[model samples]
Target: MPPGVPLSPPPPSALANPESLTRRSHRFQPKSIWPVAILAMFVMLAIVGIKAYRSLSQNPAQSEQTVEQEARLPVRVTRAETGLAQKWVFDDGIVWPVKRRVLTFQAEGDIQAIAKINGRDLRAGDVVTKGQVLATIDSRRQRSAIDTANADVEVAVQQRNQAQATVVQAQASLDRAKSDLELAKTELVRYQELFDQGVISESDRDVYLNQVDQAEAALRSAEQDVRSAEDGVRSAEAQITAAQARVTETNVDLEDTQLVAPIDGVVAYINIREGEYWDAQRLNSGSDQDLIESAPIILVNPQDIEVEIEIQADEANEIDPGQLTYVVLEEDVSAAQAAGASNQDLLEIAQDNGSRGTVFSVSPTQTPGSRGTQVSIRGFSSAQNLR
Candidate 1:
């Protein structure tokens, strides 16, 4: 405590204890502490951190609830019940004519005339009666053959008449021979009776017996000639019959020279031209000389049109002959939209509008690439009118 003497430094043990050293040491130590301000700042920071954590934990649940409410908004829906003969799935298919026929020549010949050609518009669905002529071949050779057959028949008929005359002559000769034989037998008996009664000489009786033998021999010869002549007549008659049969067959072939349509149809193709040679059996040699090849001279389709569709065996059982059906044409977006005021309402407005079609047939076999069934749709209106 002397002012002039420097305050003796505090003891090491007392300096080590900060509270005691700060109070006792002569060097000034600040009494106002800053630890309370630092503690207060730490407390404020902890409170703010707790509040922020609580807000962050609740934000995600509130956002998810808002999203769920938006997702529950209502949408429009429609339902319809339609009668269908058969439900069918679409498949890739080819269009084909309903009926087809080919006209061919009966005999090999050159085409003399062609009444029609390809691409010509023919009357649709006209019925062709039996024996109608559709096309013609060269008739010169066919007529010549027919004439030859006719000449042969005429010759055969003349020969048959001559044979008939021979048969009549043979029959007459047989009758005469039989009468002569009987007369000879009666003469022989009379001569024997006369010789036994001694009314005739021995030489005369022997001569009469010889004469009877000669007459009998003559009658046998005549009968044999008659039999030969009858046989010849029969042979000639058979030849005549065969010749007549040949004439009839030739006539039939001649009639077949002209090709005719077999059924009612529309002409589709005409392959022959006038003066064209048609040989069905001839083959091409690949040489420079061109030979006419014969195929179907004309092609036709029948009046009745039919569509064929392939379907699964299981689905075909539901189809009937007279059930009602509907067909939807190719999608027309413009037409669909025009029927309604808005795009969202188009389907409902078009339910009773647009072109109508129908189902025509169903096939028994499964179509290629189809898992279920296939059906054929046909337009009720004419093909030209259908879109």
Candidate 2:
């Protein structure tokens, strides 16, 4: 055993079995498979044994019933009740006032005042009563016109009185002319009788003839004067009639200056402000296509809020007065639809978020210029917020 001696060769037995020389690697052995298979068989046998024991412990009929009960599914049931058939219909529509009016002035002037509510100037959505003054224009011009017309009427009356007096004077003159003519005729007869009796000269009878001619001329002149006076009276009467017409016109203009609410309603719109100039011409002759929308004031009776829905003629026929209706807002409908809500859900949403209404009217005929029929539904209660 020296340190420099050569290493010796491996043993033939170790070389023949290299696996035995290193640590042995674990591998599936045929011997282990039988134990796993036996364990699984024992587990199956235990489950079957348990089932057989439980089955034998109960009566045969009771066991069958238990199995059947366990195999069957559960269900719910309710007692029968009587009820009427019901159906639901959904539609979109706009809520409008049953009575709507657009008010404008016939006379143009500067707006002097606007109606107030709760100490604030009148505006859209304000409530008003019938004949309430919604606004007023400067009425001085119309008032002046009325005064002028009245003055003209008074002047015409004066002229008429003066003419009547002239007529009376003319009548007096006519009467006097008649009396003079009679007197002249009587004198001529007397002169003729005297001349025939040779108690009057021919020259004197000729002088009586000249006096009768002069009296006739005076009567003709008086008749002409009476006719002239009567004409003056007729002219004065015509003037009076014309002046009265003017007065009536001015009164109408004055009324036009004040915008009055024609119905009990809410103010839907106000196109004018205090101190703004009002022009009637725009109402009648403006280029705007809708005169009503352009009016100075717009009113709507929201207490009679009616939802106007256009539907197929067939659908309209199914609707009747007093039928229940629900009006859901467009936003609610959209949201509910986006959430994939069912019809019942939509109805519930409408009940919670929208107004309840009743079918007020259903048009028998199609709407004018449209193929759809109009169905009107009014709120069950007065809805001031509908409009």
Candidate 3:
């Protein structure tokens, strides 16, 4: 120990007194102060977090209430109860003809006349009546043929007359032959009697018998000639009949050279013009080739028109031919006008007033590009006026 340093009391020996050293270290160190400070900080933070969460939760309701107060304003509305038929439906469609006909020619020839012009305005779709000359063909050749046939018929008539005269001559010749045979038989009998009485020579009697045989052969030959003449007359008569029939046929052909309308209708189409060669029964060139054989040369549509619709098979079964129905032309007519009107009103007004129509028809096949059935609505021109 240094002088002047009063040796502090000898330091306690931790090895000898471990418990005393521990107590001294413990007294100098803080035991619970740090734990208490940390706990207080945690409590302060918890309180602050609770207060913030409550304020955030209540803010949305306060903002919503303020907005609702500001939004209270004024508005206006209109009221009208328009009547509508509940049973009606609407479908799209196109207008088409109810009845149509076509015209054509019977014989091959050049067309000389055309009474109806293309695009000609017609009244009531009226058409030319049967036998009405629609066009004429160049009939020079046909006329010549008819003349030839007529001449042949005249010649046949003359020949038939000649045949009849021959038949009469044959009858006369047959009568004469019979008389000659009778006379020869009587002469032969007389000669035989003379020979038996010995009033004539035997050679003379034989000569008389020979004369009788010759006369009989001549009569037989005349009778055969008459029969041949009669056969000739029959043949001439048959020729006359055939000639007459040919004349009749040629006349018919000549008449056919004139093209005529077989029905009465408005000319809807015209395929030929005056001076145009309309070769009948031949395929037309260019655009006219599509004409059907039974088609008329002119197309005439009847006054009546009908609408067709394609509907699904299932829905179509519910419709009957005469079933009553209404149509709503939503796009064509105003809703106000259509409301409260009967189904018949749509049709009647359409016809008389040219109003848009609201009459409908149902069909049996599904409409294209649609999932359900199709229906057609008919409208009169009058109905179109109810726009």
For each candidate, how many residue pairs have backbone atoms clashing (under 3 Å)? 0, 0, 30
Over 4 Å off, model 2: 1-92, 116-119, 125-129, 138-141, 280-293, 317-370, 378-387
User: Candidate 1: where is the Cα deviation over 4 Å?
Assistant: 1-85, 89-100, 116-132, 201-203, 263-265, 281-303, 310-387
lDDT of 2: 0.82
Q: How much is 256 displaced in model 2, in angstroms?
A: 2.6
Residue lDDT tens for model 2, 1-387: 456765454457855996865644364322334456779999999999999998789898998998899879876689998653434555656666778988888888889999889999998878899989888999998999999999999999999999999999999999999999999999999999999999989999989889999999999999999999999999999999999999999999899899999988888877788888988666643322355457898898765668888888777777789988767667777888899977777777767777787988888788666588888887556343354
Give per-residue CA lDDT, model 1, range 271-345, as digits (tens): 566577776654333421222233443344533333345556675677755454333233443555465545334
lDDT of 2 at 126: 84
Instruction: Report the error of model 2 at residue 355, Å.
Output: 5.4
lDDT of each: 0.60, 0.82, 0.62
lDDT of 3 by residue, 145-245 (tens): 88887788788778778877877887787788778778878888998899999999888888868877887787887778778777877877787788878
Ranking by TM-score: 2, 1, 3
Give the TM-score comparing model 3 with the true structure, all chains together. Answer: 0.52
Candidate closer to the true structure by lDDT (higher is better), 1 or 3: 3
Q: What's each prediction's TM-score? A: 0.54, 0.62, 0.52
lDDT order of candidates, best first? Answer: 2, 3, 1
